[model samples]
Target: MKIRMRTIGLIGYLTLLMLPIYWMLNMSLRENNDIMSRLAFYPHHPTINNYVQIFTDPSWYMGYVNSFAYVGINTVISLLVALPAAYAFSRYRFLGDKHLFFWLLTNRMAPAAVFLLPIFQLYSELGLIDTYLAVALAHTLFNVPLAVWILEGFMSGVPREIDETAFIDGYSLPRFFLTVFLPLIRAGVGVTAFFIFMFSWVELLFARTLTITEAKPIAAVMTRTVSASGLDWGLLAAAGILTIVPGALVIYFVRNYIAKGFALGRV
Candidate 1:
């Protein structure tokens, strides 16, 4: 009886969690006319036109490409910068090390909105406006701190003896970190990369504020749904559904490592 109750509760919880996604999928298959004309749990007449338009339209598909480019850049930059910083924090004892670490995390705590103006002005001055690099760099400001926080925790768990043994064996610092130390914390890296990628992918404020057109992200482009005829509900829903796919795939591939990452890291 207890097991039955638990099972039923789990099912209910999952249904609640997945309700929005299922609704979005249902909406994506429908026309704006069909959607606004009635309220139905399922699409009475399913259509693929919404998805088709997204693929065929340059404005729509280009948004996706631009988004992917920035996300990839931010993820790589955040991880690359964080790994060394995390290692330094985990391995060394220095003046105000804890204070410095705390300061880094504080950057992550600040809302992205606060940085919007400064970033905009700085990028404008640098002539990086409407570029993939601008958005990627802006995202890195948030992602790097988080990557450091999580990576530091994982790096700390690694025994210092490994470093000593590697050095004793004449392994170079880069070689040891690449071949020996990194493998041990592979789960943490995977989790960090996923997090940075997702944050950059979904973040609209920075992405939208920084780029006008050439580097506009998909989330920002979703706003274009507002037209003289009102919102294109079907098209918007399909884009939303497609937007979710990459994040879903990232989670799926890293599902095995995510648990270990959470358990092992500061996350």
Candidate 2:
């Protein structure tokens, strides 16, 4: 009886989670006229025009390309910068180490809104506005701290004796970090990369404000659909559904690492 009840509860939970996504997909396949004039779970007139527009239109698809460019840059930069920082924190004691860690966390906790004006002025002066580098660098203010915190946890779990043994064997610091230490924490790196990518990918305020035409993110592009025609529900739904694809693909590739990384941080 208990097992049956648990099974039923699980099914109910899954349905609630999937229902909205299903509706979005359903609307993407539908015509705008049918959507507004009727109430139906399934589309009355299924069409592929919405998806076609996304692929064929330059303004539409370029947003996606621009988004991927910045997101990839941000993820790689965050991991590269954080790895060394995390290693330092985990392997040795430093002055005000705890305070430094807390300070990094506080940066992550602070509202992104607070940094907008300063970020704009700095980027404007440097002529970096509307460039991929601008958004990528701005996102680092948040992603680096998170990457360091998570990587530090995984790094702490590894025995310090390994570092000592590597030194005794005459292995250089860079060689040990790349060839030996990194593999031990590959799962944490995967998890951290996935998180950084998603944050840069979905975050709208920084991406929209920092870019004009040459580097506008897809999320910002979607907002432009609400013009004189009211709203292109079909096209809008299609774009939103497409936006979720990269994130889903990231999860699929890192499915194994995600569970392991989360588990290690517990204690």
Candidate 3:
């Protein structure tokens, strides 16, 4: 009886978790007329027209390109900057190091709204507004700290003896990190990169304010669909569904790494 009750509860939880996603999928598949007529458990006449429109239109697809371009760049830059910083924090003791680490994290804690004006002005001064670089650099401000935190945990799991042995073998610092240390932390790298990509991809405020045309991200473009006439519910639902793909792909690739990443530094 207990086992049967547990199974039922598990099924119920899964159903609850999946209901919203199923609803969105249903909405995306439904025709506009069917959707407006009344709320139904499922669509009477399903169509792929919304997805078709998005793929065939330049404005819709361009936003995806811009989003992927910046988020990809941001992930790479954040990892490059954070890997060494995390290693330093995990392996060595330095002046005001704890204070400095916390200070770096504080940047993540600060609201994006608070920094929006300054970031906009800074990008304007550099003549980088409405460009891919602007959004990528802005995302770095938050992503770097998170990468450092995640990578530091994994780095802490690595023994200092590995560094000593590498030094004795005449491996230089860069060679040691690239050839030896990096492989040991592959799981951490995957996890950190996944998070940075997910956050940067979905973030809209900075992307919206900093980019106008050339580099506007998908999240920002989704907002433009709502007009004074009425919400473009079908298109909006289609865009919302599409927005999950990148994040879902990232998680799929890193799913194996997540458990190991959490276990890192515990020993």
Candidate 4:
């Protein structure tokens, strides 16, 4: 009886969690007219036209490409910059070190809107507007501080003896970091990269503000679904589903590391 009750509760919770996604999928498979005309749990006359249109339309599909390009760039830049900064924080003591670390976290604490105008002005002056580098750099203002904080926590957990032993064995700084130190905090790196990617990918304000047509992200493109006739409900639903896939895949791949990060890092 207890097992049966638990199973029922689990099913109920899952159903609630998945209801919106199922509804969106149902809408994606039906015509907009059918969607407006009736309320249905499932599509009676299902079609794949919405998905097909997105794939075939350059404007629709390039949004995904442009998003991935900048998101990739942001993640790489955040990690590269964060790793060394984190190492210094973890391994050394400097004048104003505590204040500096707190200051980095302060950047993450501030609202993105606070920096938007200044970032736009800087990028415009630099001719980085409407480019992948522009969006990527804009996102770093937040992601880098976060990456540094997380990586620092993970690095702090490592024994200082490891660094001493590596140096004693004549391992160069770069060689030791890549071959030994980084592997020791792989979970933190996975978690940091996942966060950086998701933040950059879903961030619309900076991406939209910085780009025109060439570097528009999918989130920004989704807003253009409205037309003279009305909203393209079916196409919008399809794009929404596709937009979710990349984040879902990232979570799936790094799921185990995320669990470890929660346990091991200062997440």
Candidates in order, TM-scores: namely 0.95, 0.95, 0.94, 0.93
Per-residue alpha-carbon lDDT of model 4 for 1-267, expressed as tens digits? 999999999999999999999999999998888889999989999999999999999999999999999999999999999999999999999999999988988988888899889999998999999999999998998899888887888899899999999999999999999999999988788888998898888889889999999999988888866644379899899999999999999999888777655443754
What digit string (tens of lDDT, one per residue) describes model 1 on residues 199-256? 7888899899988989999888888655544798999999999999999998998887
CA deviation > 4 Å runs, candidate 1: 227-229, 260-264
Global lDDT of each candidate: 0.89, 0.89, 0.87, 0.90
Say which prediction, candidate 2 or candidate 3, comes out ahead on lDDT. Answer: 2
Best first by lDDT, ranked:
4, 2, 1, 3
lDDT digits (tens) for residues 30-87 of candidate 2: 8787778887898777898899999999999999999999999999999999999999
TM-score of 2: 0.95
lDDT of 1: 0.89
Clashing residue pairs found in predicted model 3: none
Cα deviation at 124, candidate 1, in Å, is 0.3
| lDDT at residue 135 of model 4 (Cα atoms) | 95
Instruction: Please list the residue runs of candidate 3 whose C-alpha ends up more than 4 Å from where it truly belongs after superposition.
Output: 259-267
Tens digits of per-residue lDDT for model 3, 126-204: 9999988899999988889888988898888888999999999999999999999999888778888888888898788
Candidate 3 colliding pairs, count? 0
Q: Considering TM-score, which of the candidate structures 2 and 3 is the better prediction for this target?
A: 2
> What lDDT would candidate 4 get against the real structure?
0.90
Residue 44 of candidate 4: its Cα lDDT?
97
Q: Which ten residues in a row have the lowest lDDT in candidate 1?
A: 258-267
